[model samples]
Target: LGMRPPTPAHPTPQYKGRARDFLYAGAEAGVMVLNAGADVMRFAPSLVVEEADIHEGMQRFAQAVGKVVA
Candidate 1:
């Protein structure tokens, strides 16, 4: 049984509006996230999610980040 480590908590406090950027980008990429602060994006997933769902979500989220930082 092999499993990857959990994603570390990423709290953005110095970059202004970064969380907001992620929020919009994630939405466009089919991922949902919340801006919990000026630069913090809150992430929450369904309790009854499957492994495949998690992978797909991460892929979409990565796409969103690419859009925001590119």
Candidate 2:
């Protein structure tokens, strides 16, 4: 499990939002995997985010999974 600071230095608003979404998505996927008896979550920092970037990451992660599964 990797924990990153919420905000990145000198990030544009759009990129920051994307990062938050990705982070949220990744976390949700990780939880689902864990519940399904998976061993690990290979989480990494997005290299940027805003102070309000928590739940957005999970949403982004869920979107990614939808695409791949579709």
Q: How many residue pairs in model 1 have overlapping backbones?
A: 0
Off by over 4 Å in 2: 1-39, 42-51
After superposition, the stretches of candidate 1 with alpha carbons farther than 4 Å from their true spots are 1-15
User: Which candidate achieves the best lDDT against the true structure?
Assistant: 1
Location of the lowest summed lDDT over 10 successive residues in candidate 1? 1-10
The residue pairs that clash in candidate 1, if any, are none
Q: Which digits, one per residue and each the tens of the lDDT, describe model 2 over residues 1-70?
A: 2556433222244343244343344555652211211222334345554535546654665576455435
lDDT of 1 by residue, 1-70 (tens): 2444434335344556577778888898887776766666666776666879878988999888877777
Ten-residue region with minimum lDDT total, candidate 2: 31-40
Evaluated against the true structure, the overall lDDT of model 2 is 0.42
- What TM-score, over all chains together, does every model reach? 0.73, 0.31
